[model samples]
Structures are given as structure tokens and as C-alpha cells.
Target: MNQNVATSAPFLVFTDLDGSLMEHDSYSMEAAKPALAELARRGVTPIFASSKTAVEIIAVQRASAITAPFICENGAAVYDSSGKILTAFGLPRASWLDAVHQLRERLSLRFTGFSDWPAERIAELTGLSEGDAGRARSREFTEPMIWQDTQANFQLFQSEIQKLSLTTLEGGRFISIQSQFDKGYAMKWWQARHNQPRPFLVALGDGPNDVSLLAAADAAVVIKSGKSDQLDPQGPATVIRTSIPGPAGWNDGIRQILNLLDSQQLLIY
Candidate 1:
């Protein structure tokens, strides 16, 4: 939280990280620095909502010099700026991990999850540094995994997991196993805390997992991605798509939306 940023502003930007605010491969936010600076200048709080774990999200916030709170593990939990759990939507990671392990053994599933891999292997798979990979593995809830089985087997796995009261979400690079809650549930929970002047929520994301997040927002920005299954969030009254991909697209989308809101006098600061 930059001291210059005004938390009193009636606006909030909830953004995804991996392929939305950061680049897909390089994992850099260099291109979005200008937009971030503008956000700070405008006194708007940017809350991160991602599949990353608490430690990983905290590390990203530290790197970016941001102290705002975050929603982690694909809406499994919300943590304050200091990494304290504000609210949790899903069961503990161990519960989900145990169920996944049991299903894998019973169904002979062929997926490699974070709990089954070493930090080095996770680093190799995700292009993250070994240190960051370790942070990613420090999950309090949910398990992100790469599916390595046939489509039919994957469907069987999903069916079995659903029977056990678990759900799966396909992210930018991995499919995560967790409880039924999605990003929208977490966002609304966070929003409910503000009663004086409820914030105007804006969400930006670029994956199937982000669909709930986008739909939860009063405004949504769908950042372009190189992947064929580009997201089309349907609920928001204002949905803007960027032409470019990665952080550049993130930057453009933010600027465009802010300008649009300002022109329409929708921002109440």
C-alpha cells in the first residue's frame, strides 16, 4: 500500500497475475509499470486475485512495492497486506491434497501436482526460479497440476473428484483442484466489508478461471492472450478487450477503462 494511494476512493481493481498483469512466459510486469504508477496516482487500490499461493502473491506484492490485500488459490482464501488470512472459502490444502492423492491411486490418474513435485521440478515445469517455485508450493489451499492422462481418463478423474465435493479450474497453464468457490465468491466477500461507499469493482483477467472474477465486476477487462481459448466474460456491463497480450495489454486495458470511467464521471474519489 503506497501512502500516496487513497484507500478512500470508491474504486477497486482486482487483477489476475500470471498472464494478466505479468507476461505469460517471462513473468515480468515491466510493461505495466506506467499503468501501475497511474493507478497509484489516481489513488485506486489494485487487489491481486490469482491462483498463486499466499507466499508467492506476497512476494509479487513485495517486488512491486504494493501493500494491498490479495485473493489467492483461485478464491480459496483472502489475505491482508501483511499476509494474514482475512477470509477463507475453501478447505485446507491437506484435505484437498489427500482427496486428490486417493483419487489418483484409485483411478490410476496420470497428472503431476504441486504436492507430488519438488521445487526444481516445479521450476522446470513453470519456468519459475527454484525459490519462486518453492513459494508456489507453499499452498494453504488447492493444488495446481498438469494433466497428463487421456481426455476420457481426465473426464473420469473430474467426475470422481466432483463426487467427492471438489471442483477443478483450468488456469493459464495448469488445472487446479479445490473446493467449489471461485474468484467471484472471494471478490464479493471482500467487497461486503466496505459499507460506507461501496467500491466500484473492476476486474481484469485472461483465463477460463477468470470468468467468475470478470462476471463479479461492475467493469471487466479481458486481457488478450496467445492461447486459442480467449476469455469472454459475459456479465459485466462494461467489458473491454485488449488488442495486445500480456502486461502491455494489461496496461492498455487499464488506461482505456480509466479514461472511459473518467469521461463518464463514474469514478467517485
Candidate 2:
């Protein structure tokens, strides 16, 4: 792959991390190196939009050699390439926890979330190294929780959370408690913030939490996930799925999307 393949216009990529670019268990993005290299060469901006914390996203950014902006904590915050936060959507973690405390006592919604777990516990649960788990534990605007109640109770909890104006998302693993904005809102806000004309948006994700993002893109690719079953994004946006899993699937999806974009003269390399 040429490192000098420059694109005529910016190709905006808003991607998920865990099961899309990074391997589920190994947590490595080695297989996506080809596509990463190509995107870097073409100067196509790849921005991570995940449920990961800033430090976790930083680690991935370092490994992937990406210097563009990133959306963190399930779109609760957006940060620029220079590591500066561009925008924030929700209240701080402490405030949310305060609300959770109230809800827990009042409604008896049984749950265990990232905020309730220490770094060591989180490490054991997610198979991340201690340091990475520590970073993951350092959430800002959201809490990813596991419901420990019956179906009726869970539905009740979801309804009450909604009434509080908070959003509950069912991801591949945890049930995420987030701000009103999802990844799709973050993607759109990032695009709108760009001074350049609207770029062709391409998003790739593999989990159920990624549905909104896939739905928002001009071209969305759903990678095969090892941690979860395939998702059906019920949206009008052009969509595709890779047969392979993990970063191999990611590589295929990005390359294929680039070719399709090139054909439409929407991209150059």
C-alpha cells in the first residue's frame, strides 16, 4: 500500500473499537493495519467513536497511529486531534452516579456497572490489562451497566431511566447508560463542526450500540463480531457486512467502501 495515496476530499470515518477495529479478546488491531495504512496514506480522517474512555481511546490511537479527533464514552464527549475536548453532551460521571444512587434506592433496580467496579475487577471482567482496565474505569459521562434483574424489572428500569431523560442502550455486553446523544449524534456534530463541505461519511461497527452510527452514515459497514451476533441496522443508508471477523473484516469493509466511493468520484487516491 502506498503511503502517498492522497484523497481529493476528506473521507470521514467514525468507527467503533472493541469488535470492529480491535479484536474482541486479544484487543489487537493488527489485522486492520492494511486498511489503517491505506486510510492514513489517503489522508482520510478516521475518528473513533466508542463506549471507551479517553485513556482507552488514547491507547488505541497510539497503536493505530491516528491523529484525528475521537468521540468517547459512547458519544458523551468529542475531542480534537491535539487531545483537546471539543464538545461535551452529558453531566459528569459524579452527577450521573448521584442520580443512579437515587434511582437505585427508590426503584431497587439491581445492576453492576463500570462505575461500581474497581480497576482490578474491570480488568478481570473485560480481559484487559490492569492499566487498560484502569483507563476504562475512568469514565466521564456514561456508565455501562449489567442488569441483574428479571425481564419485568429490567423493562421497568428502562422506562424510569427514560423518564429521567437519560438513555439506556443495550450493547453487545453491558447495558450502557448514556446522555441523550448516541454515536450518530456525535458523528453528525463532528461533521457539522468541520469547516470543509460535507464529506462523504463512512462508518463501521459491529455491536448493537452501533446501530445509530451505521444508520447515520452515507456508507455503513457492519463487521462480523466474535463477541456478539450480527446487527440489522434498519436504515436507508447504504450498508454492507463483512464475512470475516475482527480486523480482517474491518480491512475488507474499508477497502471495499473506498473502491465504491472512488467509483462515484466521491473519493480519490
Candidate number achieving the greatest lDDT relative to the actual structure: 1
Most accurate candidate by TM-score = 1
What stretches of model 2 exceed 4 Å from their correct place? Answer: 1-8, 226-230, 234-236, 265-269
| C-alpha RMSD values across all candidates | 1.8, 3.0
Please give, for residues 194-258, the per-residue lDDT of candidate 2 as tens digits.
Answer: 55567667889998888888888888899987533557776625788899888899999998988
lDDT of each: 0.86, 0.80
Candidate 2's TM-score reads: 0.90
Q: Give the alpha carbon lDDT tens digit for every residue of 1-269 in model 1.
A: 36332456668899999999999888999999899988888787689999999899989988888888899999989998778998898988777677689779988889888888999999998899999999998987788888989999988988888887888899988999887898988998988888767788899999999999999998999888855156777778888888888899999999998898879845543
What C-alpha lDDT, on a 0 to 100 scale, does residue 230 get in candidate 1? 65
Per-prediction backbone clash count: 1, 0
Query: What ranges in model 1 sit over 4 Å off?
Result: 4-7, 265-269
Model 1 alpha-carbon miss at residue 260, Å: 0.6
Model 2 steric clash pairs: none
